[model samples]
Target: MIENIPLLVTNISYGVTFIITVGFGLAVYLKSSRKTAHIMFLFLSLAIGIFQICHVFGINVVDGESSRSIFTGSLSVIFVICFTIHWVLAVLEKDSEKIKTIVGFYTVAVGLVVFYLINPSAFLLNSVPKLYLPNYYEAGNYYWLMFVFFTVGALYAFYTLAHAYRIADPAHKNKLRYFMAAIAIGFPLGSTAFFLALNINIDPIYSTLFSIYIIPLAYGTLRYDVMDIKVVTKKAVSYALIIAGIGFFIAGINWADTLIQSVYTWVPIWAIPLTSSILAVFIGGFVWEKMRDIDILKYEFVTVVTHKFRTPLTRIKWASEMLKKLIPVESADQSRLAVDEIDNANGLLVELTDMLVSLRQVDDINYLYSFEESDMCKIVEKAARNMNKHILDKKIDFSLVCADNIPSVMLDARRMQFALQIVIENAVIYTPEEGRVSVSVTQENGKVVVSIIDTGIGISKEDIDHIFTKFFRSKEAKTTDTEGMGIGLFMAHQIIERHDGDMSVSSDGIGHGSMFKIEVPKA
Candidate 1:
């Protein structure tokens, strides 16, 4: 057995560290902060990760140690050079000088790679006595040049950090100090690994200190909120829990396997399914975290995009109103119709913008809500009035039946109005012409219940379950109204849930109509 315990342990540490650094980079990218410096650092992490993996393989994969070590060692050195240049670029502001330096560095890196490929013996000797693995390469004449290149690149990166620190604003000084300190401590410790190539045979484990390089980045993330990257702390803790659980479960599997083999006559077939289920949980947690992160970015994006679109919409509405006032009374009916259409279009755009903004705020726990004791009957009446035009146009018999002495509920009036409006309007849209759309409010089970029943295309059993999911449109609804964005019920559900209320829908299959009931606590 190749019993190099220390080397094996070092490889394992490298593997774990690589996983961490790479995961952090991916999480940052997934957050959609999209800062250039963040991307550069991610690239730096990736390069080092490749190096660590290669190093592990060099030590463990014995059959091709000679060639593998040389290639991995050489490739790792190149990556170090690449990261060094990228690090400098990340710190410095972009300019003509920066571009020139980048181009020059790229040229030099390419030249060095070509030189190494053509005459690798000048940098690494192919033949050497086996150490712990197989035959390994030794430092050669050109090796100093490669070392000098890495040393220069690293020094420049540190120099850039120091320079940035000196001239930075006082507010930024502490953050830069943290970064400078991390690079100062981490790089030197990691650099000692280069000595191993020179036959110095120093303790190689210090090489893993590269992982410490991320300490400052993480500090920057939490302390300065650097790169505008926001990481939910609880999510991070959850990830830690997930990782620990996976480790514990893996250990348990091994222990169980051993116990079964030793103590029992045969292994149980059920063990495989049990192991798979545990693994599925671990995988599911990881995927769930990713989905949640993406959802955050999605909401932020929605907010920005809707805000941009809202500006033009506001201008259009204002301009159309102004034009209407300027038009003479004797103007043709066509002109009036065109002006009316513009006003209608502008209203739709305004409503859509508001809906997008509200949806974006749905996931935020600290979302502002002005709650007060408001009459539930008055709220529902106002919502029903807002949809009176649509109900009338459809010739639907829409009635608001509110019980006398209906108690007030503590709620955000505007949001509650919006929620109720959505429910009522959806009822008007889906109900067939001349169908009945009735809204009722009453106290039930110590809570105020608002129910909207529509005699129109009903929801199927399968569709009812998913009706409240964002952007989910039932087949019936899609055919009935192709323009529906399918967010009304979703927004209504979110608003009600936030108001300490419950929203549910029931239907007796398609063509039988549906009922939406919302129950909020009475004040």
Candidate 2:
């Protein structure tokens, strides 16, 4: 049991890492944003956490296979199976948008539960006893089946993460790359421990080695924000190597203990010191990286801060220049000109402030808002007129048609305008030169409906649900000359919801035109 220290440490570390990862996944889920990748991510984290906890604490952790353990461990089977299916869904699913990775994962989850529920046989527990080892804690013969399933599940989970890590964009590439690398290293190590536990090797030392993997996992997650993965993996590798070094030290202590076990019941139990030394060695290197080379965080921080200052600075300059020219002719009406010029600068300032606020709020997925009353017709016209230059440049025959009986609605004017702009801009982006883009408004069932109908490359049904997702662009969107950030529609969706409105998109399939319908409650 003493020899199991390193493995226990590794397992505990993995368990901690798993907890944080799952928490992050849930955070994204609660934000009214849903995506296959994120949902799969949540399940994967949840399952990994569960497995790590089981390994670290063992099934009899609380009271050695007590009824509580059975219940908890049994419940974990569902999560494990779901994690596996999360991968299978990704592997088999051709449609990127219509996938329900979570709900789909749960299907396998149910199967796992039902099988165990019907048969609480040896696969789950050999004997429900108060103590975990030496007497009541022999693994059931059918435990191999569970091991088989778990192995398959872990493989699929890792596979999905691996694929995601490879294709993620630069903004997130490094974090994901390291996170996946951590998973890659730990999963294999974990597998080795699993096989060893199953009589492949009856050594307690394997458990210690397995437990130590958690340090790397935790380091990857904490040091690099691997959950929100960005590019830059040097720190992650450093973290892993630290874990490796610490692992060796722990191994040394285990060796020392075994030597003493040959002579005495125990030695000073020096593994903790060795573990700390390993951590210190790696962490020392981490500190050195910041001093010796460029840090990505430094660059990101500067970039974000500079953008804040630069945009407003440009706006202020433009406003000043415009005022300067006008003042040369209109300076005689001093007070009036002064007020107008100040208002111009103020308006730009207000716009900049609002942009920054929205940027921050948008990061919160669950952001909701208060609604105000405004004219739908005016809103559509305003958005179109605002982007008139873009319309002309694109050669899009943009038009706004409103039914004579169309009514005003209760909504946030600024938000509605933003939504309208996104939809229109998206239409313009998707539409080819000379292609027509029509914005039509109508009153239907006590609602004001604004539709942006484009005669451009249409979205397929499979891709429609994903259009409103953050950072989700269709293959078509990627191929076009359109330089899109893919957040326009997502932002629009949030804004519409804040206004007590609803937005939906439809496309027949590939090459068919798409329509974005936004409906807000009539005032």
- For candidate 2, the 10 contiguous residues with the lowest summed lDDT are 224-233
Could you tell me which 10 consecutive residues in candidate 1 have the lowest summed lDDT? 221-230
Write one digit per residue (lDDT tens) for candidate 2, span 1-523: 4764544455555544544444444443333234453455456545555554454445324455453353335356446456445533442242344256556656655766676667666444543332123212345555566566656666666676567657754433454555556556655554554443354544433333433333444343334222223222343344434444554465566556667757765545565566656766776787677745564565456558757776776777677667666566545766545545465445434544554456555545665555666778987887787666567778888788989977767777776776787789788878888889999999888888998889878986556645776667888988984567776777788778666577887777676678889988788
**33-112 in candidate 1: lDDT tens per residue?**
33455566667666776676566656554454355444445455566656556655654544235877767766787788
Top lDDT prediction, candidate number: 1
What local lDDT score does residue 298 receive in model 2, on the 0 to 100 scale? 55
Report backbone clashes per prediction. Answer: 0, 18
Residue 343's C-alpha lDDT in candidate 2?
A: 53
Reference-based lDDT, residue 246, model 1 = 60
TM-score of model number 2? 0.47
User: What TM-score against the true fold does each predicted structure earn?
Assistant: 0.48, 0.47
